[model samples]
Target: MSSSKAGSSLLDGSGGIQPISEPKAGPRYIYYRIYTKQGALESNNPIYSNDRFISRIVSRSVAPPHTAACLKKHIFRIEKFELSTKCTLYSSLSDQAPVEDSARLALRGISGPGVSEIDPVVLVVDVSDAKKRSKVTSVEAKDLVEWSPTRRYVYYRVYDEAGEISSKTAFDDTDSCLGRVGTLCISPPYTALSLKYCIMGAEGVSPDRVCNLFEDEGGENTMKDGDTVALLSDNYPGVSKEEPLAIVYALQKDPVNPSEQSNFTKKLIVTVYGTWGDYDHTWHTTKAGEIFHTDGILLKKPYVTDSEFACYAAINSSGKKAFIHQVYSSFG
Candidate 1:
């Protein structure tokens, strides 16, 4: 796996959380370590299992880079002939392709009732590795019932014996690496396709609108790159009045450089939208973040804007996603 050389902070979002003191001495202790440019590349990466190397992992197609990359589905496909023994393939920790990594995987084993016959083990450096003078701690396989290694600025789920994800680790301020928003692109309008609205009181009555970005120079959607664009209302002419007002939406993408064409790593953004008005605000749509190909960049979250505005998803020239929003002049 390639190490990230770009400068970034270690999950600076949560200012209230204090820095982890050190690796506590115990059977099971959670340790936090930061990997700067110098320490990013560990001697052992792409940890293998049963002497077989972990290759390509199934990743969701995402657009532009620096958006939140969802490590959703990782299927380890190994030909029957590749396996020297009967074993399930586990994914390597980082988002990097195993074909690119030549490092040897440090193998460990845990034998118990539910453990796979050829289960894979993770390799983590002692906290002291980050702080040379600090005391080195050991995390044994028995003590660690589950270990999800955070790498490539994306956190993944811990897999159980059945190859099912036991639990998902959300992005936070305490991880080995940190992610940042990448470049922004705004050009060549794309289509919005459709919009579906669901209200609390109304069950079987959802509304759909045919909306397009029409994103030319000096367009109605006055949004810039990285700004949170909320689709506030169904202001379209033929829209029904029964639909609720003050709806908000935010679309987020994964981390990938748009300028780099060879990077097949597709970018997919989750469109999370809710109502933002008064104190009665509530979430209307949960899983609305779907990316369509129209050629553009993807929109990411944390809605860092100088003022409030509404946003919509569009596309660029390369069939990637983009974002455009309508600014509320009063906020400026």
Candidate 2:
């Protein structure tokens, strides 16, 4: 090669082409301001006459193209500003057309060389409906109150079985009880099941175990699972620590299998303690003079009657069917 000048070489000693360095570019940004008003747009008064200035927003130039709706939502999220359902954004005080949600900011001359820190694009919002909503929300918050009910306490006693209280000896003897006497604090509208659970917890018994609750110590006037505690107290008043309500552990009977139940039929010899006849003529009647015999009796179905007690359907000895009041007959 010809004699190469010391400073004329374009390549380095590695035989690779040398690259030229360029100057670094500065960061770019879009700047804008927001203003809000709480009334209808007026041409004579002008939107910027008495408008309130919100925070100024600065966005990077490299960000994706933004629409009016997108920018409004972003401002709402960043500023935690609430807007009403019916509101609109305007580019200038004199602008007759509102900025559409899909309209691009760049296309609308909101962001470009014309926009600057001193002469930034201004966004105006009409929040007349928003003011109404805010007022309503404030009033509702001021009127809100917490719900609280008065607490009441009730005392109860537990027995091993119904027979224990039936003889009245268990009521007089503390040693005859299944557990020590317990008290329950109840609020109105409490259910009987909830009371049972409280008693079960006090007696240290399993929750799955069944317990029968009565309003009286004699175990009469049974309390159903759905009965309200307030109603039960109304029916039987004057329950105190000296005379507490009675609770008995129900005897657990083995469940009859469906297959065995299908192959077998049960017949009960019921004795009528009083003379009763079905006034509705839907079923037969029973006379106290004769011992009524039935082939099969359906006791599960609830018969609607004026009597306070429940009624059951039974087939009489003469093959006649009738509904019998539960209190008039004794099943053997």
Which number leads on TM-score? 2
Tell me the whole-model lDDT of each prediction, alpha carbons only: 0.23, 0.44
Cα-based lDDT at residue 113, candidate 2? 24
Please provide, for model 2 over 1-332, each residue's C-alpha lDDT reduced to its tens digit, 9 standing for 90 to 100.
Answer: 43354334546654455787865433334334443321122111111222212123455422356677766665554434464333355553324345787777652234442144333334444333233332111223234333232323455666665455322223345444523221222211244554565555556564445567788677678876555565234333114555567777767555433234432233434455331331123333444444433334435433324334355555445444455665565554
Model 1, backbone clash pairs (residues 3+ apart or across chains), number: 22
Task: Please write out the lDDT profile of model 1 over residues 1-332, one tens digit for every residue.
Answer: 12232222233444334466765332211111112111221211122232122222211221223121111111111111211211111122221111112222221122211122122221222222234423222423344333243221111122222332222222334531211110001000100211111111111221221112212212335223232222222233112222211111233234334555443234334344321211011101212353322133333322323453344343323333334332211111
Q: How does model 1 score by TM-score?
A: 0.15
lDDT of 1 at 62: 17
Q: After superposing candidate 1, which stretches have Cα over 4 Å from the reference?
A: 1-100, 108-332
RMSD vs true structure, all candidates: 24.8, 31.7
Measured by C-alpha RMSD in angstroms, how accurate is candidate 1? 24.8
